[model samples]
Target: MARLPLTILGSVLFVAGCAGEEAPGPGGPGGPPPIVDANGVVPNYACPGSPGCEKAEGPLLVGVAARPITPVLETWDDLDGDGVRGDGEPFDDVNGNGEWDGVWLAGFAAGRAATEIHDDVWSRVLTFEQGDVSVAMVGLDLVGYFQQDVVKVRLEAAARGLDFDHVVVTSTHTHEGPDTMGMWGAEFGTTGYQEEYIQHIVTQTVDALAEAKASQKAARMKVARGEAPELVNDTRLPEVIDQSIHAAQFIDEAGAPFATLAVWGNHPEALGSDNTQLTSDYVHYLREGLEERYPGTTTVFLSGPLGGLMTTIRITGCPDAAGVETCPQGTFERAEYVGKGAADAAIAALEGSGATIEDSPSLAFRRRSFFIQPTNTGLALLVLTGVLHRDVYSRDKKLIPREQQALLSLTNVKEGDVLIGTELNGVHVGPLAIAMVPGEIYPELWMLKPDGSSYIERPEGGDFSDAMPETPIQAVLPAGVTPVIVNNANDALGYILPQTQFDDAPPYAYGEETEPQYGEENSVGYTMGPTLTKEFAAMYGR
Candidate 1:
């Protein structure tokens, strides 16, 4: 397990810029345009009453909206074995035609095309505005959304005259949804992404954001945390499960509920890989249960730290739909049970626990762009072969032309040779501090005891057995603040784990025979864990 030289690209601050310049598309001609300025810096928007702002004081305005993004399955037979439905490939006429449809289910194995829709997926948005500063937090029911798609949504929102200081988009990381990240397509080299469906998602998401913004109302906020270890399972060793559910409830001045934001960790794949139906999996049930309990309130769900392979796959001792006391593996009943159980925990925490409700809380946030040089050769091959659509940059931040990328070999991707730009966003909504992480962050990175020591024990024979634990996010937050960490936000670069437990080489971390532990194969690289933790700490001035 040889390590590559680590390169630290400085952060790009968001700043106000001149108006009327046409914003470039995703990975535009030269590169992606600066968020606002010519130098590619995003414009910052601070709370009106704080610091150098010039606006009258106002109450917190909140709004929520949802748009269905369920993909319409096209009847394609793929008769010629090529992924594309060419002219000669006729549609299968048989009633029980098992030919692969256009909708490829995201997680688990490839070729898992969707044959039916069990539940509709969506792009749910929650918008908040205090004085002039406004921000939108979107939760999508999908596997993962790339940075390229996020950029497209931002540009589209701006084009539609929607002005927001910042937008944070996150995915529920549902393994049952349609493929959006391109890796879970039909074959190894071929992508299963539907360009038309992706565009539909972007358009619908922007529209949802606009709707939420237009429907804002003065609201008060309350936050709470609940724990339910019975609903989550950590497959990897050093079994540290993030069983806490953080909820933020916004209420209208008239006492009606505006929206309830629920953040929890665990893969939403309760239905497992054997099912071919398209669904948001357990997330659909969670939202349903919440909305049912709190009438007139929209429930928005965001995934928390689920990296060290948090999942519902082999969980045991749970009651199923038939009232049988057993873990319902690969069944829709298990998804419902887990989802409703999470909702119950959230409700109990918010109602029974003594939570503080804040009025006129100020909003402050910071978003910075950083780069990571991808070390996963499998990921590199996917990008180089056009299976994954994204822009790779050189050490000098120059875009590597597509033609050049196609010609480059796996060995050509050396230290600092191929970099991908992602972002980290930190926001303060009164006493609630939200950290928007871009991938499946391992729970060990954030879980800390009162003494500030990691809760996870390092097993012997790990790849970096002597590596120091990165700073826990909770250790740097201001006193009396509740930390709400959301993962799969803005981008999904795979598992962001602790370097001490990265087990890609021989003598794996947890004594697994014949293969390394589950996480590293899908991760961007070993450097991602250290890089993200350091940058996250720097963002908070730790």
Candidate 2:
């Protein structure tokens, strides 16, 4: 594999080769033993070296890229473009198959789009030496909770026996994309591309790693943090004063912007569910915006746990508020909100942090897997209530075909079905950890500290149908670690209610609509990001 000729920005180095092998290459960074060439033979410094040969050189990078994966969610027959399927339904197959197998012709907008199986991917950097760090990134239409699709991660991590915990996976929270978890109680619909799509991710990342290995070089680097006002908001229905600030991380070696890893907590709902074409949601927008500011800079966008923090506030409040304005003193519609506030926060961070291309990071990344069981409270109840609609349209409005059987019919969730707790407080990118969770994280499950939540210290006996963050994640980074929280890094996992509220709310949600409990429960279900965070920080924070 060939490197993309892109400059690599990273911290730390891990020597590669046999387990008990002696140092067969040049001393790293400032280590000596390179100027004096015995026999004028520069050691083969990259890739696989000659058997036991003490001198050889090879490439050091893996590879990376991002693609588009979109799914159709609506048909024309409903006239309103809701999820309903009608006689004049667009994208319907009126043929004698008894099933709408082929796309039926009708009004263009009303037709449900064809199903897709591809996801956009990014970097796959493989480290080839001791003290070396490699990274790759990808963004797909589906969410990544279904670790089943992570077979590629296992294979790649094991390609050289690297730890699976070393690989990081994430998803952008675009409501417009296909369901990552089974929606409407059915697991068959494309959650974008699930476990079956692992090969593509694996292949792309493997190539990326090879390339990164080749592109390795000694370069000066600096990390600067700034806030962008564009990413902020208080879009809650009641219009409370909250923030979802966007923070940009600028990394440059030799005084140039090589990459921008931006962290912000907000739903990637800007691309609206009505869209059927594959896209990276607000990520596409932000990536392009950053690219215009700095060319050749690989922009890896990470999300935060924004369920409770976001307001869906409309831009500039131009459209006024959503929901019942007169009914309450200050109520805002859920959809009228925008994320300009988050972007603004990042702008602020950028302006305040100044710029740094010095003092390389001390990087140490490790990954592992655990069995996660679904609380199933949310899905089970939705199914019983006839809310399970396998063939969902763009707006999430339920559709019914007068003569067709329901795709949402009850079914058993097999071993491979997505079943896991959500990360209660970690922002994620491949191998990167975001420990900061700002906003009112339900105190029910978090172990709050000035540094970060200690999720691993959590008590074991409890049940949640409930929901639940923080502060700047970087401030809490361990003495030797630099941590950043990418808001909404996981999913639109709803609120994390306290334990007292858990028993009261069988299904947790974070809203006034919640029953009389310590915390509220909603249909969206509770999150485990905090739990995952505690475990990860305890295990990986060195």
Best candidate according to TM-score = 1
- Estimate the lDDT of model 2: 0.34
Error of 2 at 499 (Å): 3.4
Which residues of candidate 2, in runs, are more than 4 Å off? Answer: 1-64, 67-144, 156-165, 184-220, 228-231, 234-254, 271-278, 314-348, 351-353, 368-433, 436-477, 480-482, 487-542
Worst 10 residues of 2 by lDDT: 10-19
RMSD of each: 6.4, 14.4
Q: lDDT at 127 for candidate 1?
A: 89
Q: For candidate 2, report its TM-score.
A: 0.55
As for candidate 1, its clashing pairs are 14-42, 15-42, 15-43, 34-40
